[model samples]
Target: MTCSEPARTTTGRLPGGLVTTTRRIRRTLAAGPRVVIAAVVKALGYRLVRVQYHGTLGEADGAVPRGTTVFDDEVPAVANLDPALLGALREAAKDAANDGVEFFVNSGWRSPEYQNRLRREAVSRYGSEKEAARWVATPGTSPHVSGNAVDIGPSEAKAWLSEHGARYGLCQIYRNEPWHYELRPEAVEHGCPPMYPDPSHDPRMRQ
Candidate 1:
């Protein structure tokens, strides 16, 4: 179909193979600058859009890091975090190592099924949905399911991350869990937003 054809449809698929290009732009804008640039290229009528078309734009330019063993599981665990996040962690770990600190991953990139199981376990461990929500998130809503959250460990590492992680867009989002971190690249420019007090206070965890 021509650009003159109705661009709006329930599917949001534009004629030149721009499936959901409009929503893609919004998500791109929300995700970060690199993805936004990818969307901009598409918005400017470029049909050659590639790589950046994934919902999160594939680490600014398809630069996913090779998985490596670390602590509990490994890099790119069962679900695999965003490559950019993995990259940042690698660099941070190197710097941390130089300071005589060792970083370790307690959990990373859990499958949705795994997340739900954890939630159920949390309910069992914590005694109620309310208490469980204070720690674990529901399946679809958890950043771990989306490969966007990680739980790091070893007190020294958490301490170093607390002091230096914002430099790499990794931040402890929940005040209650210092080991839990997420990539918010904007943190590099805008300063790590603000903590949510706990998962109970995080709006995303309300599911």
Candidate 2:
């Protein structure tokens, strides 16, 4: 389907928590005959298994150290990002490069496995899964796993980008995570939920 085509089928809740339009259910039925019966049954409100994030599978170990660098231990695969957003990020990076600001992609996409590993490690180190979940969003909840979010900043370029990033279609979601930005448009009317919401007034908003 084209990008302009509506991605979501359901407008309201289904019998279970599943939500989708009758048209989509029918289409799926017609396209995959073998699974048609099961699909129809699922359409009645059997929630589909939560999609596992597959983006972080190939990430190098210790790509991002535990230090306070802008990078995250896991990120979504860059290939999954919208083409337009990816182009915009590259352009933004190039612009920064021209200004003599060295920037790198500290984190991009993350797979479910990577997120789970981080979660496990956090619990092991911090002695609380709750603490781990707080610091790192549970797999599916992470924007980095969407491949549309990135953290960017130089040791000194933070201030400059803070003033100019929006021009490149990037916005900082959390004030505390000054290095993190995503390709969310100023005005988004359709498609999936934004990777990052505007930071809240709470000091712990980023975490």
Candidate 3:
């Protein structure tokens, strides 16, 4: 449907009764063969690397710095989160804890310097700097840069979250990275793609 067309529910209701859906059929046409090729590659498991908080990379490591406090720590910077989203997450965590699954925020809000250092380290180890880009996003492009994203719980909690996180406005963005979740509704609606780097030719790449 065209963007100007008013959305309607199947039951012929308007307002909150209807869900707004956006289609990118025309945008895909303009995106050309590359988008299709990328989709195919993604389907074939030529997927991006999953980064996690406190994950080790070689001896020096790269992910989030060790010993950095989680978002739920004392005097939390909960202001970094959207209020509604934060409340939802807190309720979700409490619910999980009630179910005997402990949930905790592991990381949030990365500085540009930290992201840059990670990008540089990944480049050094992987050889192809472009390859590094696939895993460690450039500073401005990172969701962590926005301070609205968080890595939650631990490795063991992955399965539990996969089964139940959606009830609380959280979803694992990367299939392989269980800890990461974002407050963006678009992420939930679109089915969270792994936080891969923007394509090399993407205009944002130059930044």
Candidate 4:
């Protein structure tokens, strides 16, 4: 439905949908038609946020931040993180290593092609698009493809980071993803923001 569609809308609700749009997000979405409607709402909104590629994924050559660098003999390979975010992650990882926990970079700086592949793989594994979207993000708006996110791994590393990451301005953005961390500089001063309950409700997914 277009924004002008008439079915009556309260603040935050989609113009013609019954699934209430919300600011407080959950990390996992239940599989159902209402959730499917929420996915469509987010999908449409994402298209509008892409000022450059017009919602095309994996073609963001212009999205690369200036001065971005690749890994240099690090304990684990992680490339294409935002320059400042990489610095913060290294510092945080160094500290975590002191506690006998090393953060392994499972993914970093994914291309649109790569991200889309992940989405496809997820859809196959989960058996449906709506269920897959609750986990893997569509490429165009994924922070990872834009070099803004890194997934850390190893249960021990995730455990250590969960407890101490905020001190270094690192934060886990999703409630269900314990190993995903992003550089949230404000966390150093105010601490990490609360995790989104799930991607379906996360306002960021729409952007």
Q: Please give me the total number of clashing residue pairs in predicted model 2.
A: 10
Clash counts per candidate, in order, are: 0, 10, 0, 6
What residue pairs clash in candidate 2, if any at all?
Answer: 10-20, 56-110, 56-111, 75-109, 75-110, 76-108, 76-109, 76-110, 76-144, 77-109
Residue 177 error, candidate 2, Å: 1.8
What lDDT would candidate 4 get against the real structure? 0.69
C-alpha lDDT of residue 172 in model 1: 95
Model 3, span 1-207: residue lDDT tens: 012222332444454332221133334546776565444333333453432335333312224444333334332333454566677677776667777776555656566666677779889988977777655668887666566667776655556767766666576665445677766455545644444323343354567
Per-residue C-alpha lDDT of model 2 across residues 137-186, encoded as one tens digit per residue: 55666666656566665655666566566776676766557777676565
By lDDT, highest first, what's the ranking? 1, 4, 3, 2
Better of 1 and 2 by TM-score: 1
State model 2's lDDT: 0.56
Give all candidates' CA lDDT scores: 0.73, 0.56, 0.56, 0.69
Best by lDDT: 1
- Badly placed stretches (over 4 Å) of model 4 are 1-77
Candidate order by TM-score, decreasing, is 1, 4, 3, 2
Write one digit per residue (lDDT tens) for candidate 4, span 11-107.
Answer: 4546533333332223225565455555655644432222222345432322333223234433222445688888888887777768876766666
Which 10-residue window in model 4 sums to the lowest lDDT?
61-70
lDDT of 2 at 30: 58
Model 2 stretches with alpha carbons more than 4 Å out? 1-77, 187-207
| Per-prediction TM-score | 0.63, 0.51, 0.53, 0.63
Question: lDDT by residue for model 1 over 1-207, one digit each (tens)?
Answer: 112333333334457445456666777677887667756665655544234233332222122234322332323462277778778888898899999988767777766666777799899999999999999999878888787887787899899999999999999999999999998899998879889988889888766
